[model samples]
Target: MSKVIEIQDSQFNDEVVKANETVLAYFWAPWCGPCRLVSPSVSWVAENYSDRLKVVKLEVDASPDSVATCKVEGVPALRIFKDGNMISSHEGAIGKQGLQDFVESAV
Candidate 1:
């Protein structure tokens, strides 16, 4: 099973912003092709770094409030949160290596 938590706008604060540990919030959409391409990397991070990071995915179309709050202009956006704040973000289809580096930079 995947370690990635499928979250919505209502759960964003509790799941990510208020969490005690580091968070990897993935913003995506069902119709976004790049989202699909980057999904594997996200999942890989979730599985491999579960001990240090909390991974959550929010569908852009379904979670408008979170999308707007995060200022996510496009799909496949990855935001790293720590101490109830966003520390880093990348908007695009970053491959597995890039995702690894991104997460490593925060945690």
Candidate 2:
């Protein structure tokens, strides 16, 4: 599988909430500066933690339903889901170490 999968509202349930393994959904928007800053770290984590986690990107503007469902008021939201439920979430541009800590703490 790819390091990161671009997710849409229609696939959110089957791909994320019900995923067998832990999933990190990175919710972002095209115009958000913070989102851009956090994107690389998200991808890096995806590649490094391929076994422990799954990273999926969700564009807020295109996925309104998921954006609302996830309660994302801003871009660069990172939510971790396991066993069909959300375990943790962070809403801002976080660095590589911060992202690592975020995932490590949850898993």
Per-residue alpha-carbon lDDT of candidate 2 for residues 4-97, written as tens digits (9 for 90 to 100): 9998999999999889999999999889999889988998999999989999999998999988888898879999999988889999889999
Worst 10 residues of 2 by lDDT: 1-10
TM-score of each: 0.98, 0.96
lDDT of 1: 0.94
Q: Model 2: clashing residue pairs? A: none
Model 2: residues with Cα > 4 Å off, grouped in runs = none
Per-candidate local distance difference test:
0.94, 0.91
> For candidate 2, what is the TM-score?
0.96
Maximum-TM-score candidate: 1
Best by lDDT: 1
